[model samples]
Target: MIGNIFLFIFATGALILLNKFLAAWLPKRNPKEKYLSKAETLVFIIFLLIIAVTIESYDVNSSVSVFTIGIMVPRQGKTHRTLIQRLSYPIHEFVLPVYFGYMGFRFSITALTKRYYIGLVIIVILALAGKLIGVICACMYLKIPKKYWLFLPTILSVKGHVGVLLLDANYSKKKWWTTTIHDMMLASLVVTTLVSGVLASFLLKAREKDFAPQKTCLESHDTHEELRVLSCVYGVRHARGTISLISALSGCHGASKPFAALLMHLVPLPKKRKSSELLYHELGDDVHGDDEFGTNDGLEINDSIDSFAKDSKLLIQQVKLVTKMLNMHVEICNATEDLRISIVFLPFHKHQRIDGKTTNDGEIFRQMNRNVLRHAPCSVGIFVDRNITGFQQPHGFDSVQHVAALFFGGPDDREALALCRWLANNTLIHLTIIHFVSEDSQTESPVRNTTTQDNNDVFIEVAGRDQTEHEADRSFLEEFHNRFVTTGQVGFMEKRVSDGPHTLTILREIGEMYSLFVVGKSRGDSPMTVRMKDWEECPELGTVGDFLASSLDVNASVLVVQRQRHSHDNFLDD
Candidate 1:
């Protein structure tokens, strides 16, 4: 018997090593492969099943071998893990119910008695007490906030599927165990799962009332204070570009007033109802990890953030380094509605792959952007980074950072200009304002401009509403120029384009010269924008911004700004 035990142990260890080898080797050999093909995954599943059966044939527990193999499967990246999880989901959902039913069939309902019921109650009480006590102690030791104390313990006490598996394995191995014990164990599992779920739901609902207040504007009480920005990072790939953009906006290069950023890392919730707590716990741990503020230069660090495609730690660390070096205060948290922030920045979802085709997981990210735009209290900026991995100081460290704002006479354009004004305070930063006007609007009859009298004129003509709007825009622009641009602090230029094609050509030529382009989303139904409508892929990025984003060769990063809807009325008087 001892020799047989040794043989089983050796076999199990060898199989685990083999599984690990395959999981690591296969991905390394095919670096470009996002996931195992269906046929390949099928073969892997068959091989693991065969091993389980072989272990069972030898009078050894097959569950351990199967569980080990499952755990050994390495999730190399987000795309890889997503494919694997999605492919395995149907199989698990279909088989779990059948497996549970078979297990239930082995026990008789008639076995339930008063004595067994008493024993079951005692078991549940002890389990709940032990889990709660342990969790409470850990939370206290770690200095976790008191609000999560009860919720964490209650949720952690829930054990269903794993318990069922362990009971089934034990019953198979020890056939002599009585039916009453099995029934009681099953009953306990059900009660624990249901109780924990209910408690969790109640806690979440209660916590909703304690949300943070909303921020309606970016303007600080003191005009000289720092601008607070809330930047959202979806994954590690976009982290570098997002940080670079934040650095520029923060005016890190010798500015009197710097920007403070709340780096809200976005983590998608799992499909399961109780998965939210798991995400919260994971993020909490990440925040508490060593070097929470440590600077990491490499982008390939091994900081995993809730089973996503890549290690978000590397991204977070890089963001920390940039923010730290810039002397900015950076706080990390999961994205939520209660955040008191102005100007939410989101990274564009789709990216150019090695094959030159733009691809992403799907519309989930786009929907996130839309939701944030609809509900964000202040202005929102969606950044489309085209291969821009952080900013490089062109001519040593003293060189000026070229930033251009493409103004097209709208509230959104004005918001973009406002952001540029803050950025221009840095002496090392050069801001260029390019105001695009239609050729027709620019060459309007001079007689029309002089006839508009403010004093009471008896013969009032209600025509030329467009001209009045044009004059209003010109008035606002002149005031903006005199206050911000005319001091020789920034460069300003105006370009009149005949049509959409002409506008696109000029933007493309000039955009290549700058490091970043800031454009508005609402480019009022002008003929120029109307003609360029066919080329727009993402309408969220207005006509010019979308065109710039879609170009494969364009190296400049784009920030598509949209002002809050309520603020628009204040900017554009009837």
Candidate 2:
């Protein structure tokens, strides 16, 4: 029976991996990803029907066996498959918590009166210590940012359900005071969860208060969404936590500020920045560079700055919507070394778009940054306020194993690789660099027509060129492999050149195979264009990056490194 159960577990695990692979790799006929493909959906439905049939045919114990087997059946497609995604969450969240709580319930009060008391105390200490150790090791091992190192551990430490499940699976058959042990374990689990969650809440609240002043000069006032948005743009974890805290605080009805702080403790920090460069270009400008920032020659304007400013102004002009909202004065400025603008945020600002001619606050900021980047004769860093790290330990990866970096012989790309090198060590991430050469159009060439319609076919048609591209990819693989040979990484390297119409699109399509995107922050007069090769169209700033972040959708983030951190005393830095 035990062997059968083990077999069942293995089969179910394999099927789950297969399902995930198909979900990620299959081409989507519908671009929106609104519903699972028709064929997959049908298979999923059949899977459900088989489970239902098996349940009807078997008794409770037999049904358990059947259900275990049913999990192994392929269910690749189904309508609203993501809707089913929520179910696993409950198993992870609520059921798992209950499982752990039940384990705590297994402990006996009488055990404390016996020789077991000292051992139990040691056990409890060891458990907590183990989790903390894991967190610390992850941080030091991954070299995570100082701020993230705080909260990452607390959130990672909440092992309620899964831990309980594992304990039960392993100890269910034990007869040595088994029932008592189970109850005590269950009860302790409950206590641990409540206590840990509370601790997390308080830590986050304190961190927010600390960072609020640093985020923007608006320490005197309470307008924070703009700052939150900016942090989101930076892909900093602290920024994400601040946004959650601000959103939660703003929506709370009767909670005292202290209580609000307590609740803020439990939230996880943001993993990635908002990632839409276009929005910053658009809305950030409007807020900072209104008529106050005069545009000189060759200065491009963004739309977000104006949007943020205008929206903020409107919130103030129409105070009824946010009468209960806190109004603080936060100072905002572009830290670009070139043309720039700075603005003081008041509680209320107007947000109006009139025939494409309406002016607002964020738009002003966007325009100001653009003016600076184009003609300021220097770089810019927009500083809003200053706040920093949470109190909990950060969650870090085991070892930076298997890292991949994208390089295009540009400074930004080189800078990105340099950053990776700084982060690398023996036990850290294994790095792979891909440098692809795109074919330039042959000028005034006599064309030969071919019947092949597929793009992959075109690449194959060029025999010598195909060999050249493959050799380039292989050479990269050999170089990295040789470099890491002594580090117990038997091998490390992979590369490919995509002659696709859009670099960003190709990046997105194939990016999921890697852990993170390490592309350069494109700027200046570099020949590296954001233009989609297929259409010869320049996408808005941050378009490809944002879409890629959204599509990958799971534990993936993009890092946009500033060549140098711009000096700006206005925004917060903590």
- TM-score of every prediction relative to native: 0.48, 0.33
lDDT of 1 at 567: 35
Error of 1 at 88 (Å): 37
lDDT of 1 by residue, 95-144 (tens): 88788888878767678888788788888888778778898899999777
What digit string (tens of lDDT, one per residue) describes model 2 on residues 1-574?
A: 5765565556455545655555544424453343455676555445545544543343212334334444543332322233354346876688767855665565567654466555556666676677778887888896655775657666666656445554454444457737656655655665566656776777788796442333222111232222221221222222333232232222223322221111011111234535555665576744432221222100111122212223322111100010111111021223221112111111101111323222334443344333322332112222221122111111224523344555543344444454443223323344455443333422221112233433422211111234454344334333433444335433222222343334554565556554445444443222233343234211112333334333423223344332333334323341
Clash count per candidate? 1, 121
lDDT of each: 0.62, 0.37
Model 2's lDDT to the true fold? 0.37
Candidate 2, TM-score vs. the true structure?
0.33
